[model samples]
Target: MDIFADFTQRINVAVQTVLTHYEAGDVDLSRVTVEPPRDESHGDLATNAAMVLAKPLGAKPRDLATRIAAKLARDPDVATAEVAGPGFINLRLHPGYWLKHLAGLLAEGSDYGRGAPTGRKVNVEYVSANPTGPMHVGHTRGAVVGDAIANLMAFSGDEVTKEYYINDAGEQVSVLARSVFLRYREALGEDIGEIPAGLYPGDYLVPVGQQLAERYGAALRGMDEAEWLPIVRDAAIDGMMAMIRDDLTKLGVNQDVFFSERTLHADNGGRIAEAIEDLRARGFVYQGTLPPPKGQLPEDWEDREQTLLRSTEVGDDVDRPLVKSDGRYTYFAADVAYFRDKYERGFNEMVYVLGADHGGYVKRLEAVARAVSQGAAHLDVVLCQLVKLFRDGEPVTMSKRAGNFVTLSDVVDEVGRDAVRFMMLFRKSDAPLDFDFKKVTEQSKDNPVFYVQYAHARCQSVFRQAEGAGLALPDFRALDAGALDALTDEGELALIRKLAAFPRLVQSAARAKEPHRVPFFLYDLAQGFHAQYNRGRDLTHLRFVNPDEASISLARLALVKGVATVIASGLALVGVDAPDEMR
Candidate 1:
């Protein structure tokens, strides 16, 4: 249970009672929050109820705080409700309260941190890297962030769909098809010579070319460019997508939907055309000439009339063009159709996980969401910053198979999936990340993933040690408040306090669309567990497995189980494993 949330309600009641006693008018209590004291020495939980409500009620904060603390002090659960500073209420719960909650934590087990279900359907579209090649290192962070966000939302009780947008209808795939054709000729005993400047030079496509040669033989080569382009394009897109899916699987990202852009342009651009007509009907579409872009010279700007969206009416800085001068739909038009399709599919909340370079697309996409949903839906875009790889402080070299950039598989294969995922989320998505090869592989506390995983391994080792010592293990399911009667140490209570904060953390992280917070929480939790373990090493009374003293050992074992359960659950949300033993 979230003790902070429970106290938040109690604090609300205390504030209401004080207001009624004073006959003060109804005040907004929404701003009042109950959280742990930044410094644990202050108290267990702290609230700013009096400070938030004092000014509106025309009273001194400290005076109001005394009244609220008096009311809260009457509750049995609150051992002390002291007025701190100007108006904050610092609460310290009775030891009995934590013992009861520890029993509850053991009972809840894996479900301890799960949130109440909200009937909201969310669509998280991410890692929609073009299907022209394998996923590069540039795409790895977004993929990991997006996947973890989806997992986090699901764990927090929102029905989420993980999606990938395939840019198959774009010109890049056509270039891919041509590139593969060159390799196919090379596979068929032709000297294709050096790869042309505009074509992809990656040897990763060689297998696709060889497969095409094996499947179609000389049939494709005899046809005209138009006739063979579609066939080769289909084969190449299929091959590249297969490779992309494999790489995502290696990184543990399982997308539920792979929406193709080709679907948006099928039937003479029917979906895009329909989306434009819908906007026109809503009076958001217009015919106009955009002024020369701010950074572009007048002569470089096109002066022709064009079909455009009145995106500025929503929130975009400038109007967006829907149809280019060539009478074809622009990429932005495809994005519009895609948004419309998702909106039609009953998704009220859409999240886009794009690269940091796509910051310019944020306002336009929000404008599209506002216009297409008619202000009924919510849209969020999370832009992930670049990741620079290193090897012992030196910049890593590129992959020969990928021609220039490093592939996702390269990083995963070197450091393993858990290290890649945990490190990717170790920092905020918008902040730059520097990933080093050697450091992540180390097993010390300097490696956050290892530190966290080792905590779990240590917990298991405690139980194994008990078994080896012939001490009967406590039944976790049968544990209750009475079973924890011997846990009076301040250190033990502090650990319980940290475990009690998990539900609140999950709710806050999911609401904010920030999965990085999970790893941060796990790291701190591990540190606490490690510190407690070291304390046990110094003081025999705090040890978890005592062959002679069965009561305290069982109590400490229960605490160990609680730690392991939470660490495992948090790791699952982060898409990492909580191993029982570390190699």
Candidate 2:
């Protein structure tokens, strides 16, 4: 049961009673919002109903809060309601209410914070890195964010599909083919000079060349470019995809669907053309010459009329080109067709995770999806900022030419998947992150991953200590309502209240499409657990493992276990492991 919801209902009923007495004509009740105050001393919950309606009704906010509090007092759930600090009503729930909520958490187990399903199918497409190279740190952030969002949505009752859009057919892949072919020639004992300026210089591709030579031998030595490009391109794309898949696996990410860009116009089928025609029929496509870009233009920039999408009509900064002047479909065109295909497949809601460099592309992509779907489909694009690597306060420079770039596999190898996932999600996706290798691996309270995991381990430690002391733990079936009352300490009650807020947190985070909130909530809850544990260190009487009484110990153990369960559940949603042992 959501105590916040229950309390909100009580307050709403109280406000209605006051409204009936005052006869305030036609006040908007929808404006009333009950929320936990920023400062805990303000109360369990504070509402702005009185302040919001005061000016409309020609009544003072304080007077309204006084009347509302009196009406709220009739409810047994509310022990006391008082107005404090700038017309805010602070509510103190009865102690029994929190204790009973703790029981519900233990009974619910891992399902404690799960919410009802929204029944909307959401397609979360992320880490759609080009299939020409291995994923790097930037791609890892997107992977973690998308994966966490999928997990959070599923937990909150939404149908979520984790997808990866593979850009397997593009000019970049063609470049990859040429690069691999060079490697293949090198494997055939040819003395190729220094790797060209535009070609890939990573040693990772050297093996791809060797493998191709091993498979085809010298038969492809004199083959024409057209004859060998396809064979080499397919091999290179497959090999790169394999490496990317392995890197993602190391980071604990697996895509449910790997959509290929090549499929958009493969064989005789032309979905891209069809999508363009559909838009053209809707008057969204036209032949237009784009004004020269505001900033510096390349010397090769040529002013030409090209087919464009009227994206500005929907909210884009400028109408975007659908086809380049060279008479080839632009990347934007392919993206529009891909989104159309997604909508046709019955996913009305879509999320795209992109790097910060693609910030300018967001508005146009959203506009295209809006126009093509006729506003039926909604698109949310989350842009992840850059991650600066630091080791002992020194910046770690990664150069592509020097072949010194840190791959995703490199980070995973240094610090296990758990540390990488947790650290990546410990901040807002839009904010720049500083990843310190030494700091993340450290086992201390400063390390958020360790701090949260330590709370879980400590809970298990309490259970072990109690069991070793020959204490008879109460049977789950036999524990009565009164047994829970033994947990009467203020800190213990506060921890229970925090646990009770889990479902609401999940609901809000899911609705906002902000999965970073989960890690923040876990950190707050861990702080509570740590505070209570540290308090026991000073007050031996508050300890969970009391030698004097077994019943009290059993009740306290159950409470600790409840904390552990919620922590584990929250960690699972973020794909972070909850360890029973910290080491």
Candidate 3:
């Protein structure tokens, strides 16, 4: 069903035949590659077998190209083979091949671009926001990117685990507990003045404070820090986690596993401490003094011996600390234990989606996974850049301290979930994105979300128009390949070529671990659909509902339906809804 693969196989056979006839010194068949020409006018597919083998064979590329072309000329799949611009074999496929592609699309439908399963287990950890506050715009980008990547991998036939790592045991959570306690005191009518500089001042936590007062009453009012810290910390953590889960649900992201950082060290059982000890047993951990950090040294910096990981051996910038001077495990230590747990669970591939600010930390983390797994597991970290919010061409300022930060709920409320998901994925994850409130909502071709969705809606409109003309639409199962040959228009062929490339596109994007390519491919596919639609405006005969000719109308309808099927399948992968009607 893959015309490109079919043609490549044909060319490889031809090349081997030519080599055998010439008795050319052993040619490496594995070196043969077939690809589409960068310039479309060149051909449907091109190969450089002749050019690649020419120098070693002591022959001119042009002469070798002629021999290869003559051998390939006999292939039924190849309509014509000619050498163009310095020994490039330009190949034009038979019209029947393209027609077969349309039929294949109809046959496969939603499963057309699915790939063979690798059967390897992969764990993708993303949107592991600290359970201290509601998710903001920054976390939203990571959520969408991570979720789309997991979806893409799953579609590509890999077993994927979607996970969220909760930082509930960290110092940040302690700060959150104190902040909530201040809110609790405020709820009890205590005059806690001028919300301290580093404490959370958002009104969202007021409810958490009030709920604590209602539950505990005056029992916690006169208790020392030790007596009430745990009580308040647990409540605040639970409240924050609930708020975060709600924000994720609003954006259509649901985690398969919620991993608690505290669980690694629960019951003073010290599983994390045990993990570090195991690493030390493997020579990955040792007591060492680190070199002073470059650029700027902290005013309180002091030279001291601390437990460090042998990260430099695995390619980190420098050895990393595993314990702070206060004799507590560093954040990196907890991360190592968490990844070890992932390995124990039988995942050989792990992907971490982090904010752009964590770019400097990528090498050391990858090194840790490498050392801990002893090169058995592969870890890839995708750093998503910050999103700058704009409204009417001006920057949107958000300050959590000033209680002015825009929550994820606010954005979802302003624009529906479909627009939010599509726009977030319209750009590469590593590239800084500008989210314009006014522009995305506008109904215009300039808005890519609307444009792609409109293509889907237009396809449905064609079906409705065909019904109005009193013509029965062709069943995809009943469509004849020969009848599709009537769609010989240049634009129609161009769209079909794009459709034929979908499986290859999916494989390439999945192999590269880049889900952004899906949106880019969708945009190009939408452009093809739009161009074909606009073509009908000029030539009424090309329109889908030509009442005078049922046969021609049915063929065109089949083509548009193919376009709609692809749009729906692609949008579904990225978690965007494909609408049948756009108002």
Candidate 4:
């Protein structure tokens, strides 16, 4: 149950009662919120009912707060309600309420934080790396962020579709095809030395070259460039995409759809042309001339008139080109078609998980949504900042396998999947991250992944110890509230409060599109569990399993089990494993 939501309703009722008593009618109550107090010592919960309503009612803030507090003081669950500062009402809940909630949590088990259905179809497209080579560290953050957001949304009741847009129609993949051709010639014993400067120089293409040689051999060597380019291009894209898929699989990311950009360019750009025509029918497309870019000479500008989209009228910084003077559709036109395709597929929200460098694309993408959907759909772009890799405080830059950058596979292979996924989300997606190989693998509290996983393992360890001591837990399915009454310690109550906040946390994080909050909450919960465990060590009476006191032992064991279940549920949402034992 979402206690915050429950209290919000309770507090709103109190506000309505106060307003009616004062003959104040028809005031908007949406701004009133009940949340945890900023300072734990203040109270268990706090509300701003008076602060939001006093102005509308033309009453002093403190007077409204006193009335609201007095009304809330009558609640059986509220142990104390006091006005704080100018208008906030702080509440302390009775200990019995927490104990009963703990029992309910233990009953819910793995589904504790699962949300009700929202009925909104959300398409989260991320890691649309060019299909030219294996994924590098730059793409790793975007991949993890997207996957975690999708998982979070799915957990929080939205119907989420994970997708990848393959950049197969770009010039980079053409260079990749040519690079593979060079490797093919070399594999066939031709002295094709020194890869050209403009082509890819990575050694990963050697296998593709060998495969091409094994299939076509001398036949491709004699064919015209036009005849052989398509064959090699298709082969190279397939090879690279296979490698990319393997890398993603290793990192625990599996997309539900892999949309090919080449499809939009098929039949001589039919899809893009159709999208432009649709926009034209909506009066968003026009023939226009773009002014020369600032700080550039007029001679350096493409000053010719061209087919354009009136994107600025919608939301973009400026009107964007749709078709070039040469009659080819611009890249933005393809983006428009892609968005229309998603909108037609019934996605009410399209979330783009792009790299930080794609900041300029945000406004135009939003414009596309506004123009194409006519405000019927929403577009959100999350920009993930770059990850700087370090080893023992020193920068480690080069990767021999990827030729120029560290591949995502290399990072995963070095530190394992759990560490990579957890660390990628340890910080907000927009903030720069410094990932240290030595630090993440360290088995200490400073390492968040290790700390959280160890907390789960410790909970398991507690159960194992209980089993060895011949203390059979009471049937948790039939567990009673009386058993949980033994948990009256401040530390135990604090942990329960943290655990109770998960459902609300999931809803907020999912709505904000911030998957990093999951890891943050998990870390805090782990810290609380660890602290409570230490408390038990110093005080024998507070231990989880006491042979002499079966009642209290059963209660504490159930609490430990609840902690483990919540941690496991959270880790699974982020695609991280919570091990039963950590050695």
Q: Highest lDDT, which number?
A: 1
Model 4 steric clash pairs: none
lDDT, candidate 3, residue 153? Answer: 86
With candidate 3 superimposed using the best TM-score fit, by how many Å does residue 129's alpha carbon deviate from the native?
Answer: 1.2
Q: What is the clash tally of candidate 3?
A: 0
Per-model TM values vs. the true structure: 0.98, 0.95, 0.94, 0.98
- List the lowest-lDDT window of 10 residues for candidate 1: 294-303
lDDT of 4 at 164: 97
Candidate 2 lDDT score relative to the true structure = 0.86
1-583: candidate 2 lDDT, tens digit per residue: 6777767777777887788767776667777778888898767877887888787777889999889988776677678888876577878778887877777777778888787777799999999999877788889999999999888888988898999999987779889999999989999999888989888878778889999999999877789988999999999999999999998999999889999899986853388889989999999999989889889995534499888999999999988888768777877888999999999989989999899999988999899889989999889999999988888789877846327577888888888998899999999999999999889989888888888989999888888888899876665534555788888898888888899889999888877778889888998999999898888899998888897977777778888888888899999988988987877
* Deviating ranges (above 4 Å) for candidate 1: 24-26, 297-301
TM-score of 4: 0.98
lDDT for each residue of candidate 3 in 1-583, tens digit (9 for 90 to 100): 5565666677777777767656776766666677889998888988887888777667788888898899888877678999987787988888787888898898788998887789879999999998878888888899999999998888888999999999888678888989999989888989988879887888888999999999988678799988998999999999999999999999999899999999997866387788889999999899978889888986534488888899999989888888867687777888889999999999999999999999988998899888889999999999999998999899987855328677788888899888888888888999999999999999998888888899999999989988998988767856768778778888898898898888777767766778888888888999999888887899897776799988888888889888998899989988899898998
lDDT digits (tens) for residues 197-299 of candidate 4: 9999899999999999999978899999899999999999999999999999999999999999999999998999999999999899999799876785544
Model 4: ten consecutive residues of lowest lDDT? 293-302
User: Model 3 misses residue 289 by how many Å?
Assistant: 2.0
Scored by CA lDDT, what does every candidate get? Answer: 0.93, 0.86, 0.86, 0.92
TM-score of 3: 0.94
Model 4: residues with Cα > 4 Å off, grouped in runs: 296-301
Report lDDT (Cα) of residue 64, candidate 3. Answer: 82
